[model samples]
Target chain A: MGEKVLMKGNEAVAEAAIRAGCRLYFAYPITPQSELIEYMSRMMPKVNGTFVQAESEIAAINMVYGAAGCGKRVMTSSSSPGISLKMEGISYIAGAELPAVIINVQRGGPGLGDIQPAQGDYFQATKGGGHGDYRLIVLAPSTVQEFADMAGSAFELADKYRNPVMILSDGLLGQMMEPVDFKPHKTEEELEELGKQHYDWCMHPNEDEPNHHHHEINSLEIDPLVLEKHVIHLGEKYDEIEKNEIRYEEYNISDDNDVLVVAFGTAARIVKSAIDELQEEGKSVGMIRPITVWPYPYKAIADRITSKIKKVVVFELNLGQMVEDVKLAVNGKIPVEFLGKVGGILFTPEEAKTKILENI
Target chain B: MEVIAQRPKSLRDIQFTYCPGCTHGISHRLIAESIDELGLRNKMMGVAPVGCSVFAYKFFNFDMAEAAHGRAPALATGMKRARPEMHVFTYQGDGDLAAIGTAEIIHAANRGEHISVFFVNNAIYGMTGGQMAPTTLPGMKTSTSPYGRDEKDIGYPITACEMLSSLKAPYFIERVSLLSPKEIIKAKKVVKKSLQFNKENRGFTFVEFVSTCPTNWGLDPIKARDWARENMFPYFPVKNFRDKSLNGGE
Candidate 1:
């Protein structure tokens, strides 16, 4: 109902989820993303939604699986280790073809490495956190507005694809405050209509209708041929998503640019500041931000490489995870260089500029 | 043509893969009968766990979900919450419930999630070939406990009914044996009662069937039944641990 309000990225995500008709939320409190869960806990009941503070991250994700299977817009939030704990459930949800949203306000990890902000979960979120041949629709939000907007988009994509969608934000975005607009909320009527979308596949024990078959939500395929066919079917779905859903944002990538900087989320924000300083100093530098981390905007980055641009620079808050994607995108068209800050350390805009300047 | 004994409409027309004399088929029939008798066929949703009864979803004519290991309770919780209008239940075995899924079962019961749980306690892991379960009787020999279950090394068999009874949120908790015709009749009543409670949207309800694993127990069907009756009934007594309806809630 609010036209404009100053909100934290985490809170904005929670508010956006509520507006998008996320009626069921399950979570266990984790650092950097605690506000999201707390906001859901407070707001869900008021809106006649269910909020469960589950026993563990494992339990929370499973609860998401349950609600999603029942054709409810469900979500869960957690930090790095918590997300790792949820991998098993996530794999199951993916295998079962359930639509749900997971917010990983990532922090330092490799095993509870630290509580500070980091982008170390790039591989986990995009490639596969769980043990299956699966991919989540990964969205990386750099601003509070994007954080809020992506929550709505996440549900849409998830429902459209019948897959899990993740908001892969770092602690910086989660903790930082910015003005956000919460409008165009899914109305009560719209929400009711949305609930009807999954009626065909959702678990409804409609024993009265003789023609209606039992909707069994399971991933186990016993026969080898059947399992292979199922996996191929899922692969086809992912291929469709890949063909349709690649999203990114480009800044100042005109012909004058000698080097292109590729980044995402908080790293992109820092990279933007660095690019600004570089441009002011008469350097040809631009930034390409991949908003959707999964469908990693390879073409967007690749298409920008002109005769003048000789190299691609990737700066991330992790230890060169997305750089691999950048390199693959470049495909030897130009050399790809990586600059990273790990262990909860965020490189300053000046430090990033220094790296870019040295690279050139 | 008199139909004194026929498959319940809630059951699919398929032969069970269970070992001859295994109580899973009987238990499935009783549950199906209850669903039919209660007229809950259209609204019944079942979650089958990873054990001998993992294929329970296939046997049950109603809509069902297959969960990993002991996560059936968690899966059922999601189903019940998302669609409260549908009656949901989880069918789990001893290893899946008493051991690996201890947390899920306990917490779901504690939260008073509107779901019924059918726990089959047969002391051994039937699906995985006689591995020792948490409900394995002390001194009982299982594949994992070749030398017999040592209480010091691994705690004594957990009594599921007794454990769940301690939780205040649960509306009903009962344990029954499936060793004989008489006991089977009693177990059926408990199953029906649990389902009835679930139909009313009463909080968490549970029924533990003290069953036999003839193949896993390396005994004839009759011998396995006798063994369970002699060894397990005394430990996991057949009775309701908590009935909030009678006492008018906790």
Candidate 2:
């Protein structure tokens, strides 16, 4: 393990990405995530990497598309409104089937929302925020350390699937500081190997490999039949991803539990505290934290629905997003409920415990 | 028997989809020839915009990327910055570059990104049918302006070369015409020089081709060229706007 260092969540993500062999970083300044772009700006030059403060979020995402099309590991970051501006380019990246990473340190929003942490973009992130049939392997991290770890995982998943991956963080994680031990940075040879992984399709002169020429990195298939085949092919890949990559943490789960609390990210951390307090009171309550929100760990949730569990409750910063997923998992087997705080308001641990007690 | 003319090595053997007399074919040939002459066939990469040349990726024999409308410059910026050793260029039409992508083009030029831009100003959106364009001349009839473009309501055409040359970063900025054989010969030189400068890693080269759209113009190919010469030539006058090399490049 590398020596531990104190780093902000945003900064840790940036450092972890560099260690993961990302040499091309582009982004526009947005609140809560500005530190990430700032960190890249200061460090990219030192590592002989490129950092561009793009003119707009739209430009930054397209720049990511351009670089990733060339088989280089690239990243961009923004808050909510900025992310909305990036959806168009993100869709293009997905359609082109290029590996790129986007960090959305979410702020509250439907429009010009406040610069406070919020989980309102859950639907946008998990349900293919952009247009058309596609999915970004979305990773949700509950702690700063996990935020740092997920950076490496996000890039790997993106490259493996040849799809865009989003590290869905929020204002709390971005602003919080934590001690993180990043993995060893990739050596020059390893980075070179990473670069060559996409040589078969990357946009290059192909001078050394003569038979490969005119590799077109594009999403537009003019014929409807061809496009249908392509979309179905993408669906098959997504199925493979769902099969192999669903991740979640089951905490205090037992057959004696009366309530199965479902939450993620910040809400999950608060829920963990609530479960701890409940256990002290001789009350049996459990919690499930989803690490991958899209593949969703639905089967995991469904399998844990014991007869002793009277209800499944969901906690979120938004009104009720992930609750729907929990309901789908519970599938009428037990009563499902939702508790949330919006507009940047977070449910306190005491408040979470009270909610869980009421459900129990 | 000696071969008089052949397709450039940089161009694929497939037939062009351009309509008869449309200058996009000529422009593509010039670009392909430039890539061939400079021996950048293996090194050059192109970004095709979302217009008539949207299929340019199919015709070019090198690695290519098709960008979202008006976002080609931004994509080129990403590619060039990621791999500075490789040469990149964007092919955009009037609607894609001047109207929708104005910000991307201007900002990319302002940053002096090391990429070549080939702007085709045909004065109308061809693929989407005849609609008024940012480069559409005043009092010129288009589908969007069936009664001729009204100067009061629509405003005059944008001279891309003049506007881009206003920036300090571009190393070469020139507007060329392809209405006649002699003019096309001149345009070829500009295209080659632009690519050469790009190959040399000179920053931000731009070339605007004042071209003809015979199908949309409701004229035969020859008449369309004549009309462009009579109208567009006066508004978007052919000229060399900027050459930083001539003044000792930074």
Candidate 3:
């Protein structure tokens, strides 16, 4: 076991990112996520890394794009409105197939909705917000432990798929503190080796060979035929990701359960508490918590659901954003219901239990 | 045998897609020639902004990244900071550096990031077909401004050199022209100096070229050159606004 430290979700994620070999970070100050950038500013200089507090979110995302192109492990974080400002650069990074990590500590949105936690950015994260046929490997973490843990895995998956990875946590998680055991960090020698692995494509120049030439990180494909092929190739990669990277946690899911609950991020944590209370009362309620929201554990949901289950309830802090995915997974096999608390107001376990009882 | 000018090895054999009478070709050759003269072919990195120069990655033999419009300076800042050993620069057009990317250019210059910027101000959006640019002249008739630009409605063209020179951080800032042979000779010297300063790790350097776009301007190549000299030179006034070396580079 690693050393356990009580840490806020934001700072833990930032520290874990440094441990995972992120030597460069760029960000603009936004509510609920400022701790991450502040922590980075102090620690990065100590480790001889860089932390650039950019003028705006647009500039910050572009800086990540530039640093990532040079084969550096880089990151940036923002809230809902700031992520909207970063959309163009995000799309370009995904289109260029450069590896980067973006943390969207989600707050209320659609237009600076509020400073509190909300899962309103679900569709934007999973469906590729910016223009183009691309996908972000979105990880929805419900606990500070998972939030910190996803930092390392996020960079690993980004490099493995050559795509952007998003840590989509909400403000509650960002501000809350919990004891988390961190993973072992990458050494400077390991990071040096990682740089050598990207020699074929990084922007730091390359030797010209029969099949090799100068490196370029670009998203512009003027030729339609060439672009079509590139999009198809991206689709193939997503298909492989869906096959290999579906992560979820099943709680009290058995044949005896009549109600199945689906949720992710902060809402999932609430759902788990509600299910535990309901189970104590002898009510058969189970929960399925999605870890990878983009590759979304559809098979896990489909597999656990049987004729014995009478209702599938989806809960969120937004106006029914993730319920659509739950319905798509349920596929008319059972009645799917939604319960939402909007405007950044969080629902407690007791409130969630009431809603679960009403829906059933 | 009398030796004629041959293409620089720093430029790839790819043909430029620039329109006739466009000064992008001339500007590219100047950059390419400077790269060859300094022996920086393998150590050079560039960021191409989204404009007529978006495909600049295809012309230069060195590694490059295509940035979101006006985001080239931000990208170059990242590259130079990450790999301080490499020489980094950005090639941007008017609509890119002045219009959509105004904030990016200003902040990057203010930070004094160690990178060079080559800005081409042709007063119109060339790739998107003759729209009004922030550098567009008053009374100029572009596709968007068919009845001539109104300085009252839309403000006058920004003089980037003058604006950037006011900042305390920049190491060098110059506005040059490409209208005539004499201007081109002087412009080459400035471009070479920017590249040299970059190699020396001298801080943020910017060189703006008041260029011509005959296709967008609805003029012949020679007439476009004449129009630029008459209109652009008066407003932009080819001059060096700031150079650290002017005072022995403190």
Candidate 4:
């Protein structure tokens, strides 16, 4: 039986990371996500784990890069602006094919926007924030419970693919309190076994075993041919991920429904609330929430679109990023409406309901 | 069966990539020797910084992670925390640690992370063709600071040992030079002690070695040593800034 306790989304992420055998956590204190780092700081000591308040987001991300390079489960948390500072290291981690978890408890911004919840970083998180042809497995958690659950799944996916996985939540998810049950903790021995099976590229100590070779973890290759080859290999891995890891949730989509609301993260939560109100008022409205933003539940959305859904509305906290993907999914069969607020203004359930009614 | 007067067992047979007269080789040997002496060869992991020592992972036989410039301390913090049973350290150069990664190193020390940091301050960015580094003396000229580093424009050289010593959490902080053979011996002792502290699961230990860049300084190896002593030492003095062990009137 799973035990449930009331916890904030940020606290649940921290607790789940610990339970998933994450012993190294480094982060800089930023609003919204500060609670996550604070929780880790208080909890890491009790579990014989380590929590470091890094000097900056750049430092924190690099710290994750280091721990990941050594075949250890590690994580770092930040808001939008802080995550921006970490882009360089994130690109490096992706290039080196290191498995690490990065949590972006997104707040507003192209700059120091605001502390309010915003999904403006969707393009950045899903489309590679840094300069590279790399894709992070971006997970969007609609509820506090999923935030806890995804922490373990994120680590598992990272280790499996040797790629960085980002939990792309917004300030609402980071700040909201809800019931959550922590996963069972994995023993050190179990983690060691897992690490050995997956991370042969890791820098484990080379002693006694003469056949053991040193591994150099670097993302640099001046040779264009070699770089092209490396990128191709990464491309193949991405394709494999796309085929195997697409996840999404369809809520109340049926042949009777005409307008379909598309959303993710916090926007999805608002959309769900709107859907309930719309259904109560005798309006046919439904929502589709994309859990994995990169592997992007395209198939599910396309399947729904084929079943007589006419109008689609994409709601986001950005000017229009995820709408493009929605359009691609709809393939001109339906008109895609975009309702967005940039620089940290979140859409309210009433506002979404109003938009849905107008569209209908 | 006693192993003495020989190289550390922790070090591999790989030849160092550092240029001749580069103090990084000596510094690396000192760290490896310390790891060996403490019987931490098998349990030690190191984060190698970018710049001249970027390829340090190839030199160290133990597990090593290569980090971007200035991020070594942050990386070391993660590794040390993730596997407390393993000893962790970061080998960094002036440009990597003092310039870009200043925040990471300072905060990690301030947090009193159970890791050792071996900082090599050569006064110039050697790997990147003699760019002026944070540790470069005020009047020193480099590729970037062609008109000699003007204090008014570039600010004064950062004395890392002095800076870190001011932090409360760091347990050991020392500035040593590797100019002469005698100084090399002293530098090795400091490096060893810092590693030993980490092996003993003590708090943050920092050893700043006043290193040299013969190729970048456009000086021959001997002249570079002489130049470092005449110019760099006066600005960045070599001394023990803090030692928790010496707090008791020893």
**Which predicted model would earn the best DockQ?**
2
User: In candidate 4, what are the lDDT values of residues A179-223, reduced to their tens digit?
Assistant: 898878898788778668644677665565665456667787657
Off by over 4 Å in 2: A208-212, B248-250
In model 4, residue pairs whose N, Cα or C atoms come closer than 3 Å (at least 3 residues apart or on different chains), thus clashing, are none
| TM-score for chain A in each prediction | 0.98, 0.98, 0.97, 0.96
The lDDT-based order of candidates, best leading, equals 2, 3, 1, 4
Residue pairs whose backbone atoms clash in candidate 3: none
Provide the TM-score for each candidate, comma-separated: 0.98, 0.98, 0.98, 0.91
Stretches of model 1 off by over 4 angstroms after superposition:
A205-207, B248-250
lDDT by residue (tens digit), candidate 2, A6-55: 98999999999999999999999999899999999999999999999999
Candidate 4 lDDT over B183-229, as tens digits, reads 98998888888887887877999988887889999889999999998
Off by over 4 Å in 3: A206-212, B1-4
Error of 4 at A185 (Å): 4.2
Q: Give the local distance difference test score of model 3.
A: 0.90
lDDT of 3 by residue, B122-164 (tens): 9999999999999999999999999899999998998888888
Alpha carbon deviation, residue A356, candidate 2 (Å): 0.8
Alpha carbon lDDT of residue A311, candidate 4?
83
For model 3, residues A249-299, the per-residue Cα lDDT tens digits are 888888898889998989989888889888889998989989999998888
Query: Interface RMSD in Å per candidate, to 1 decimal?
Result: 1.3, 1.3, 1.7, 1.9
Lowest-scoring 10 consecutive residues by lDDT in candidate 1 chain A? A204-213
Q: Which CAPRI quality tier does the interface of model 3 achieve?
A: medium
